[model samples]
Target: MKSSFTFVCCMILFSALIKSQTSLYMPLDIKKAYANGTRNYDGTPGKNYWQNSADYKISAQIFPKEKLLKGSETITYFNNSPDTLNYLVFRLYQNIYQFGAPREFGINKKDLHDGIKIHRIKLNEAEF
Candidate 1:
């Protein structure tokens, strides 16, 4: 009974994987770039290369005894290219202590605590 159930589960999972591959979405810009010959076959940058960058100012305090961390940050963003960015991403390193976050190497133990408490974010001295 156990072996039969496992075999059925595997068959269902395989079918799902095959169906998902065909349903994946490719954005319009990528398709247009390929049609216009701006996108190379090997996926390297073409003749017109562009990138975006930002500058960050951060102030933080940590309390080891209370196991607390507090911080504030400001970002100055530069978008030289015509590409529109709907969102920005930031990473908090203190949250790495969590139980199940992926790690490249092995770890001996994990701790549970209030993950990276960010108090405030401001842009041009206006609270965000």
Candidate 2:
């Protein structure tokens, strides 16, 4: 009788532990990475894994009274992927200050100004 009660208690505890555990939900990209051997199940980079990187050298000057900022950045990008690269994309956040740029809230007239003007872009010594 006492042994039977202990066994029942153990069984209930084991069942509760099983129900408490949950499986991790992996997204499609993560599953693909695993299948491609670029990521291991132990959360480590696999032998096939490689990452690209960039190095940037930037200098900037700001005028507080005029609310003006001027900057220049030279970025060197390393392509570690197997695919060939054709172009690179850039995002200019300051463009939001342009006269007619879309905005979620109203902006003061004085706060609006001509968006960032790119004087020139030079890639590998070739101006664009």
Candidate 3:
């Protein structure tokens, strides 16, 4: 009788342990927790872009010719997400031509009466 009782207790304890290990806990104040850098979306707080580390950099250059404009931009995107992401989407901006000339206005392509031009699209080596 004692041996059977011990076996039942052991089974109960083992089941509780397994349940605790597999169960996921959801915090109540998830947003506040993230703002405090406790529950960061990237698994860690200091490694994300908000920490301002020297692991990556972004720069752009533009040159204008007599009738055309040329530009080149580079982005050093560091792997900061918890999951290893391969592909990334980047938005490219261009100046709209009005009356056969480049117009100086805010980034309102829809408001412009001219067409849109895509400069370049690049895929990083990490994407491969």
Candidate 4:
């Protein structure tokens, strides 16, 4: 009876460990938009306009590598919405981290604004 009880307890713990190992993933598509058969004056394919309608996905992962911290980021873009999207805006929140400092942030706010032109600005303080 004692051995049977121990076997059942071990089984329950093993099952819980397996259940906790599930993974999650998201799908995204990226595309470049340009006029068909368009050629540039310099004899190269015309540049694509990122401003046209588009979709995007951003992902990050953290893993330990040989006693060091390592991570990678991937950004996927797609064009599907009607409005032409010329640029992308990404707001990274490092302030939430305990080690984050204002000076440690590297993104250039000026360049971010230059990349995308906003047609309208709306604020909903209630949402905040």
lDDT per residue, candidate 3, 62-82, as tens digits?
A: 443434444454666665446
- Give candidate 3 regions above 4 Å deviation: 1-67, 93-128
Cα TM-score per model: 0.44, 0.70, 0.33, 0.24
Estimate the Cα RMSD of every predicted model relative to the unseen true structure. 16.2, 4.5, 13.3, 22.0
- lDDT leaderboard ranking: 2, 1, 3, 4
For all candidates, what are the clash counts? Answer: 0, 0, 0, 9
Off by over 4 Å in 4: 1-68, 98-128
- Per-residue lDDT for 31-123 in model 1, tens only? 777776667657977656567788888898999898776776667899877788776677768567666767676655636554665566665
Better of 1 and 2 by TM-score: 2
Candidate 2 matches the true fold with a TM-score of: 0.70
Write candidate 2's Cα lDDT for 46-93 as tens digits: 889999999999999999988888999889999999888899998878
lDDT of model 1 at residue 29? 92
Lowest lDDT 10-mer window, candidate 1?
A: 110-119
* Best candidate (score: TM-score): 2
Q: Candidate order by TM-score, highest to lowest?
A: 2, 1, 3, 4
Q: Measured by C-alpha RMSD in angstroms, how accurate is candidate 2?
A: 4.5
Error of 3 at 8 (Å): 56
